[model samples]
Every structure is written in structure tokens, then in C-alpha cells.
Target chain A: MMETIGIWVAAFLTLSMFSFLYKDNPFYKFAEHLFVGASMGYFIPYTFFNVFIPYAYNPLFLRHNYWLIIPFVIGLGYWFRFSNNLGWLSRYPIAFSMGIVGMGVPMSIHAQILVQMRTMMLPLTNINLILIFIGTVSILLYFFFSKAHEGLYGKFTSVGIWFMMVGFGASFGYTVMARLSLLIGRLQFLLGDWLGLIK
Target chain B: MNFSDYIQKIDRRYIFIILAIAVILPLLFPLGLPTFTTPPVLSLYKHIDEAAGTDDRAVFMDFAQSPSTLPELYPMDLAILRHCFLRDIKVLTISYYPQGAAIMQMAISEVKEDFPDVKQDVDYCNFGFRNFALRVPITLGMGDNIAEAVETNAAGRRLENLPIMEKLKNYDNIQVCMEISGAAPGIIYINYARARYGVDVAIGVTAVSAADNYPYLQTGQLVGLLGGLKGAAEYEELVETFANNDIPYSEKKAQNLSWRNQQYELSKVPYKFKQARIGMDAQAVAHVLIIIFIIIGNIGYFIEKRQDKNKYVK
Candidate 1:
């Protein structure tokens, strides 16, 4: 019975959202605002219970990890951003986060950059490899503003344009599929789960 | 007005209504346009299948998807978990999105219904929602030591005590890390898990961001990729059509369970479980409708251009 009620609520929201296809009206606006407000209302308490109590309060009080107070105070400092006079205090936590990310950047670069470069530096013996090599070079060259597009360079640029167009076309096709899937999902819920039309 | 003029002047609301009808008809009467699995999706399926052979191994999955990308990501998420449970492989799911962990619980319960003998603590576990702030530390630390990184499951239970965590201590025990998201968090797994720990990484992303990740597939940084609803449909096809359910499970007493011997059938899979393929049917019909509209618009443009030229000549 609870599941049935949940389905009805979801079906109502789905229809309310679809009401915009004809014209933007009160139903769409109500659904949109309710979703935003409800999510915020849900997360505030969830974070306090999940993060604050478990990670912070328990460790400091029960486990006696007093060292946590330093970071705890630093985290609290972020609230000072709302204060008119002491707003400068938030910079400590912000800088600490920035510095940590700065240190971690180079460590991740080897994986994102070096490994990919190694793999792309292939032998080019196979047709697939050759196409990949050409495609990579031509695409990069197309973006190279130093050289004007003429003669040999122009031909490569043209090939790059074709490759980009194909990529864009594929991306567009996938977007279409993704959008249609959302519609199908709602329809499935309404037809099968709500009304029992499709089994 | 001429047909060309009518075609050119048709209101966009009409197109929207047409698309709605086209997408809806397929759900009412599904035309099962044959689904095909790409190499990337197949490779991920094979990885899950191979993980099943080694009873001690587990697959790490991050459910980082949100409500907006729900339709595309949720079906694939269900399919992968179904694959894992069907083959008797252990799975550990964590989420950074506030609501993503709830989706994780929903999916686990749904799939568990399909396989009753699949126990909770021994066969699978959920780390639940870690603070998104801890994503980096968890990603890197799990590579070194999963138990140490995640000391407790979502319920505040000790992770080391879970029967499933016995041999699964680190990335070495993990067969692969599958990041099902909007392509944002998959990069973290690729850079940290696969790159740092030498674990294979696969991603399931929405179709729009799918192209951005193809270069990773080319470079082999990503072991496999599932792009949007079609990708999920292909995965459902592979599992429903090709997964050999005849497994020789003998590592523990759980393997002796009766449901482990039950053969999987396409007919038995619930409609919710096969939502991806059903979505694909709608996708096919909608695509055909859009293609027809594109041709009509082009034809109208050409006729309008020729008529303008004739007017100039006169």
C-alpha cells in the first residue's frame, strides 16, 4: 500500500513536469519549487546526523580524539563567511583545502596524462591504430592556430573537421537517447506500475 | 498554403507532441529492435563473469549518480548488480551523492528479491554515503587498504568482521572498480584506483558526457564504458542472452545453496529489471521520428530556396 501511494505521488510529479510542454503553468512551477525545497529540507538533518554525529561528535567525546577539535574549529570557521566583521576567518579553511588539492594535483597527473600518452604512442601497424594516430594528429593540428590552413595543412584540417562532425553527431544521438529514456522511465511507471496497462 | 510552407511553419509544440506519441507507443507495444553489445560493455561483463570464478574477489562500485541522471544510470546500475549477484560475486557500493546511497539500498533490495539465497553481510555490503569531502581520501586509501579506508559499513558495523571482507582486504582482492555516474567521479576512480592501484576501472555515464570519455577507452585507461540508455540496454542484452549461469561454486557453504543452481530465464526477469531494453524500444521509435522530421525540414528549405531564386529571375 505504501508502494502504491509512492507511485501515485511520483506519477503526479511526472505529469506536473510534462505539463510544461503545452505551456509553462502553475503545475510545473509548483513541482519545481517543491523538489528544490524538499531536497534541502532532507539533506540538512541527514548531514548533521551522518557527518556531524558519527565523524565529529563521536570521535571527540567518546573516543577522546581531542586533536579533532583543531580541524573541527577550522570547519566551523567557514561559518564566519556570513559574519560581517570576522569573515576573513574563512580563508584559513579555504587555503588549507586549496593547498591540499595543489599538492595532490601532480600525483594524479601521471595517471591522467602520462599513462594516456604512453598508450596513444602506438606502433601504428594496424589500420585501427593508423586511423587513431591520424585522427589524433589531425584533430590537434586543427586547433593549431600558428599555421594557416593551406595545402597539406588544409587537407588535414578538413579531415579533422569531418572527425569532429562525426563526434558531435554521435554525442547528439546519445543525448537524444538519454532524453527519450527519461520519458520512457516515467511512462513505464505510469503505464505498468500505476495503471497495470503494460506487463 | 503549400505543403512545403506548412511543413516549414509547423509549430514546435506539434513536434513535441509527435515525439511524445512516438515514445509512448513503443512502451504500450514494444518493438524489440535487436540490441547489440559494444566491445567496451562486453569487456565489463566479462570482468564481472571472471570475478565470479574467484569466490574471494569483490567488485567496488560507486553510485555517484543523482536524480537528474536517474533514468539512464539507474537501469545500468541494477543490471551490473544483478550480474554480480547472479554469478555469486561480492559487491561493495558507496555513494557521494546524498540521495545516491538511498538508490543503492533500493537497488540492492530489488535485486536480492531475484536471488533469495544471496545473503547480505557475506555476499554483499554497502558503505553507504560517505561525506563527499572524503571522496579523495577514500579513493586513494582503498587502493592501499579498503578495510582501513572504510572502517565501518553504513550501519556503523565493523567492516573487518563482515564475512565478505575476509579475503577482500585491498585493491588486490578487488577485480574491478565500476563507477556509475555522470562521468564526473569516474575520472577519480580512473586516476586513483586504476592508475594508482593497478585495478581495472569501468564507467557507466549519461550519453551526453559519453563522448568526453571515449578517449580514455582508446588509451585503455578505461577497461570498459557504458554510454547512456543504449549502453545499459546492451549490457542487459549481454547478461540476459549470453551469461552462462552454470557456475562451479565450491569455496564455501554458501555456494551449496539451491538458488545458485537455478537457471536464469529472460521470461522470469521482472519488467522493472528489463527497463533499459524497454527504454531502447522507445529510443528506436523516437529516433526514426526525428530522422523523418529532419528530412522534411531539409526538403522544405530546398523548395523555399528554389522559389526565392525563381522570384528573383522573374
Candidate 2:
């Protein structure tokens, strides 16, 4: 059946990708390159259907609205890469998008990031929290002064380094967890969905 | 650097082999470990409840993610869509990513297994994928010529003729626009649709992008958010709880009047999410593996450093 063939193809593609984990072989390379090509080719029309024709051309040409052309013109500036004289025009939209995105960052920081970090930085009320606070503050101060960190100060800074190392260790652990989750997901598809071996 | 020094370096192949086993073993035989849903996930579920309400809430889901991220991303879309349909809310899906539309269609269809009577383009509509970015969303949400973008359903029938959208006044008919993406366009929706048009937005994004959305969620800009697989799992749990609580009866005489009877009168909800539950277990084990790797890598570094010191002292 067509469904069975689809499952097999999916399994093959997934295994082909995981094979890269063992060693950089031609199979991995072929699959990787194929994926890149397929994805890119897909994105063009995908963007065209989901973004352009609906948002731009529909409003501009179909509705005969003129102002909507602002983004349209800005988007067209990307083509300036081909024109030597007009290469500078590309920077206009780039600068505009930068300005807009830049404006968003400050708003986002005030609303989201700073508050979250502050929330994390709050004083721990428990004994464990107190030790963590003391260690974090002393280490942070040690770095702020930027001294060689010898004597009591050095000892204090060393505690900060230890806290930092632990935090970094947790982050690295989470990153691995995230990547491995994806790998497991692929394997699941190959075994359960594609091959029907585990289902 | 002697030839033996090169040999002393374990081949990357060894690392690959270990990673392969780490992934495969869990799938073949799961540990059934529990994953705790974090605060952000809880917040996201609450927001979805508030925005979608008890009425006919609509979601414009963008299921656009690479296979690399499908395991983490798809579950969130599935959970959210199932929650909406179970609550009898309408869902409208359009994909900005090409592969995304097909995937979204498939996810929606699976949800349909529960709601057999729900007709496509009546109770739901697949506008397919569009490419115009901000321009398209602004136009569509503004209630302009949306038909021009996806003129017809995926089957090539015109949308104007479709019963659901025929009377759709504007994007106001939509209660939420949820974008599950791995890239910039989802954020673009946040800025253009939610900010500009006051659309309630929820984003289900990867962990890396999830942090970035904190600002949006904090700003009250994004109504709800599901981050990676953990968030998806949490959402699924919330729906399961909602479904259980809504069930009509525990008493024998009342059993006939149970919510299950009403549910049977309406849609057929699948028992539960099979894939996401399994993924959560794999994730917990994978977290342990990563922690172990980090420790080993650090030990290797320290060992090499001590050897270098010995050489210098000699």
C-alpha cells in the first residue's frame, strides 16, 4: 500500500540522518544536502502563498490600496544585491527593520527579561538559599572589582566561580537534553510510525 | 604530538554510537519517567483558557517546524487543537511554512477522528500556506481579501463558497492565533497581528526561542505560550483534567446522563496523546545523559590539564 511505502521512506530518511552520529559518511551528507535543498525549495512558494499573495498582492493590487506598498517597496529592496548602483538601497530596509526590531528589544527587556532575571535574583529565605545568595553576591562582587582575587577576596571569588560552574553545568545539561529529545523523537518515528516495529 | 597521542583521542564515532543508543533504548523500552511542567507552561495553559473561553474560540495554527524539531513541536499543536475542538471551539489553520500546512492538515484531521461530524470549512477551514509575511497577515486579519491568499481549500474549492468563512466578518471572529514555529515569522505574527491588530496570540516555540518569548508573554502581548515538549505535555495534562472534570456522572443511575454520553452525541475524542507522553519520558532520560556527558567532559579537561602541569614540572 501507498501508506506502507510512505512509512518506509520516512524510516530510511530518519536513519540516514542518525547515521551522521556514528561517523561523517556519504549517506549522512547526501541526506543532509537533500534536506537543505528540499526545505529551501519549499520555503519559496510557502512564503509566497502564506505571506505575499495574501498579505501584499491581495491588499495592493486586488483592493487597489496604495499605502500597503510600503513593506512591498521595502521588501523589494532585497533585490538591490544584484544592482551595483542600488546596493545602498538594501541598507534602507535593513536599517528600517533594525530600528523596528531595536525598538522592540527595549520594550521586551523592560517587560520580560529584566523582571525574570530579578525574580531569579531574589533573596532565598531558606538556609540553602542564604548560602547560595551569599556565594553568588561575593562572587559577583569579586568579578565587579576585577582584582587578582587573593586572600579573603580570592576565596570569595572562588565561591562565585563555583556557583557559575554549577549554573553552566545545568545549562549544558539542559542543552543536551533538548538535542537528545529530538534524536529520540526521530527514532520513535522510524521504529513505531515508519517501520511499525514497535507500535 | 606523537601518533599515539592521536589514538588516545576517542573517535567522534564512539560519541555517535553512544548517542544513538541513548536515543534508541528509550523508544524501544521507555522508563515511564515523569516530567514536571514548569511555571511558564502553567501560565500558558491559563492564558489559553482565558482567551479561548467556553465559547467558539478560533485558532489560526501555524505548524511549521523541521523534522529536527517535529518531536518537540507537533505535540504542542496537537494538544492545543484537541483542547479547542473538545471545548467545541472552532479552529482555522494556515501555514506559512510549506511542509507546515500539510502537517497542520494532518494534525487537524487526527483531531477530527474525535469530532467526526465537524465539517472542514464549516466548523474549521484550512487556508493553506501563504507567503506575504506581515502584509498578508495584516490584510487577512484586517478582514480584507483573505480569499485572495488561499482562494480555495487544499482541495482547490473556493473558500468564499465554504460555509464557515462565508459569513466570517473579519479576523475578529478568530479568538487566538497560535504560531508553532522555529524561526522569525512567528514573531512577525506577534508584532504584526497581535500588536497591530490586537489579536490574542499564543506561541509554541523551541527552547532557544522560548526565552525570547518571555518578554512578549510578560508584556501581556502573547496571551499564551507553550515552550517545547514540556509545555506541550503540560497543555495535554490540562485538557485531560478539563475533560475528566466535565464528565457528567459517577453514580449508576446518573451514568446514562454522564458527559461521556453527551460526548458520544457530539465528537469522539481520542483516549489520550500516545506520542507526547512517550517523548516526555525520553526527554527526562536524555537530560540525565547530558548531565553525565558534561561531568565527563569536565573530568577529561582537568585530567589533561594535570598532565600538562606534570610535563612542565619535569
Candidate 3:
């Protein structure tokens, strides 16, 4: 009985969301706003109970890792952004996070940068690997303003543009598939679960 | 006005209605069109199979997507979980998104219902919903020691005590970490876990975001990928074709690594597992509608340009 009720509620919301295609209306607005509002409601308490209490409160109070109090206080300083006078206090947390992020730069350089470059230096006998090598170089060359794209360089730059178009085409195709899948999912709920139209 | 002008001026709402019918019809009557398995999907399936006999070897699945991305990513998770469970491979799951833990529970319970004898805490373990804030540390930490990294399961049970974690000292024991997400959260595993410890990483992402991981797969950073609904459908087919859900635990150890692919019977698959393929049928019809529109629109556009050029010449 509860499952049936749940399906009806979901079906109503799905129809409400689809109403936007007709034009701007109250149903669409209600569905859109409810989605955003519910997300916030779910996130706030979830963060507190799962993240704050476990990673923060428990570590300082229960585990007695007193040093955590320093970062904890800095984290609280973020709430000061709400107050005009004490807004400057928010900089502490921002600065602390910035410092931590800065420390991660070296890590990113090694993994994302250096390692990726190593993979490119391959025996490009295969068509796939050969295209990857050429594609990377040509795309980089297209961005080089030092040499005018007027001769052989122009041909290569044009090839780069072709490569980019193919990449963009693939991305756009995938986007369409993703959107359709989301629609199919909702339709399945309505038709299969609610109306008994499909199994 | 000419045909070109009429074509150009057609209302978009008509197109929407046509698309609606095209997609809706497929749902009402499934075409059961075959889902072709790609290499990336095959690679991940084979990687999971590598851990078939071993109790120590495991696969870490990070549910890094929200309910918003559920349609595409959820089926992949279910198919993957089913694969692992069928092959007698140990499973480890963690959720980095807010809704992830709940999603993980839902998928597990649904899949678990089919395999009642597959015990938890032994065959599988889930250390649920650590917020994205802890993502970096938790990912890197798990490389050295998993129990130390996660600390506890969703049930507040220690990972150290779980039978599943016995031989799992680090990433070495794990086959690959599959980040099932809408976005590229798999990059985290690649950068931190794989880059640092040489762990293999696989990604299952929403179709739109699948393009982002292509470069990684080409460069060998990502071991394999499952892209959107098509990906999920392919995985379900692979599981149906290869995993052979009825194969006993005793027989799984003797299974060959070079298991040949068989024709995936769409009708033979359960309805709960048929969601992705049914969705794919809708996708196929929808694509046909779009393609026809694209071709007509292009012809109209070029003809209009040609007519304008002739007028200017005159």
C-alpha cells in the first residue's frame, strides 16, 4: 500500500516537471522548487550526523585529538561571513583551505601532469595510439600563436579543428543519451510501477 | 515561401511531441534490440572475473553519484554487484555523495534479495557515506590500509573485524576501484590511489560525462569505462551472457579467464534487470527521430543559402 502511494507521489511530480514543456506554469515551479528545497533539507542534517559528528565532534571531544580544535575553530569562522563587521573573520578558513589546496599542487603535477605525459611516449603502431599522439600535438600546435597558421602549419591546425569537432560531436551524442535515459527512468516508474503498462 | 522556408519555420513543439511518441512507444512495447558490448565494458567485466576464486582479492565501488544520475549509473552498479556476487569475488563499497549510502543500500538490498546465501561482512562490506570533504584523504589512506582509512562500516562495525578485510592489506589485494558516478570522480582514484600506489581504476559515468574519461582510457590511466545507459545495458548483457548466475561457488573457481562471449538473450533476463535495455530501445527510436530532423534541417539550410546566392547574383 505504501509502495503504491509512493509511486503515485512520484508520478505526480514527474508529470509536474514535464508540464514545463507546455510553457511556464505553477506545476513546473512547484516541482522545481520542491526538488531544490528537499535537497537542502536532506543535506543539512545528513552532513551534521554523518560528517560533523563523526569527523569533527567525535575526534575532538571523544577521541581527544585536541589539535583538531584549531581547524574546527577556523571552520566555524566561515559562519562569520553572514555578519558584515565580522566578515573579515571568514578569511581564516578560506586562507587555511587555500594553504591545504596549495600543498596538493605538487601531488596533481605528478599524477595528472607528469604521468599522463609518460603515457603519450608510446610505440604508436596502432591507429588508435597514433591518432592520440598526433591529435595531442596538433591541438597544442593550433594554440601556438608564435607560428602563423598559413602553410603546412595551417593544414595541421585545420586537422586539429577537425579532431576537436569529432570530440565535441561525441560529447553531444552522449549528452543526448544521458537525457533520454533520465526520461526513460521516469517513464518506467510511471508506466511500470504506477500504471502497470510495462514490466 | 518555399519548402526550405517552411521546414526552417516549423514549430519545435511538434518535434517534441514526435520525440515523446517515439520514446513512449518503445516503453509500451520493447523492441528488445541487442546491446553490443564494447571493449571498455568487456575489460571491466574481465577484471572483476580475475578475482573470481580469491577471498582476498576485491573490487572497491564508490557510489559517487546522486539520485539525479541514478537511471544510468544504478543499473551498472546492480549488474556489477551481481557479477561480483556470482563470480564469488569479494566486494567493497563506499559512498562519497550525500545520497550515496542510501543508494548503495537500495541497490545492495535489491540485488541481495536474489542471492540470499551470499553473506555480508564476509562476501561484501560497505563503508558508507563519507562526505566529499574526506574524499582525498580516504582515497589515499585506503591505499596503505583500508581499515585505517575508512575506520568503520555504515553499521558502525570496524572493518578490521570483517571477514572480507582479512587479506586485503592494500590496493594490491584489490583488482580495481570502479567509481560509478555521473561526473568524473574516478579521476580522484586515478590521481591519488592509482598514481600513488599503482592501483587500476575503472569508471562508470553518465553518458554526457563519459567523454571526459575517453582521454584517460586512451592514455591507460583509466583501465576501462561504462558510459551511461548503453554502458549499463552492455554490462547487464555481459553478466547475463558470461556470469551464469546459476553457477555454483564451487564451479566459479574452475571458470576460465578466456571465457567466450555468448549471445545475450534479452527475454531470458529478469524484468528488474531489463530496465537499461528497455531504456536503450527508447534511446534508439529517439535517436532516429533526431537524425531525420538533422538531415531535413541541413538540406533546408543549404537550399535556402543557395537560393539567396542566386538572388544576389541576379
TM-score of each: 0.92, 0.70, 0.92
The full ranking of all candidates by DockQ, starting with the best, is: 3, 1, 2
Q: At residue B252, what lDDT does model 1 achieve?
A: 38
**Candidates' DockQ values?**
0.65, 0.29, 0.66
Shift in Å, residue A160, candidate 1: 1.7
Model 1 CA lDDT for position B229: 91
DockQ of 2: 0.29
Each prediction's RMSD to truth: 4.5, 7.1, 3.2
Chain A vs. true chain A, TM-score per model, equals 0.91, 0.80, 0.90
Stretches off by above 4 angstroms in model 3 are A126-128, B246-267
Model 3 over residues B142-205: C-alpha lDDT tens digits? 8889999887787767789988888997899889999998766587888788878899999999
Q: Could you tell me which residue pairs clash in candidate 3? A: none
Per-chain TM-score (chain B), model 1: 0.89
Q: lDDT (0-100) at residue B34 of candidate 2?
A: 49
Error of 2 at B242 (Å): 3.0
What C-alpha lDDT, on a 0 to 100 scale, does residue A12 get in candidate 3?
95
Instruction: List, in order, the clash count of every candidate structure.
Output: 0, 18, 0
Model 1 bad stretches (over 4 Å): B53-55, B242-244, B247-267
lDDT string for model 2 (A1-199, tens) is 9988888887777778767666689989989999889877877766665556656777799878999888789878888967989988788767765555554665455434554456446666678657756765876676787567789878887888887777666555445545665776777777677656554
Which candidate has the highest lDDT of all? 3
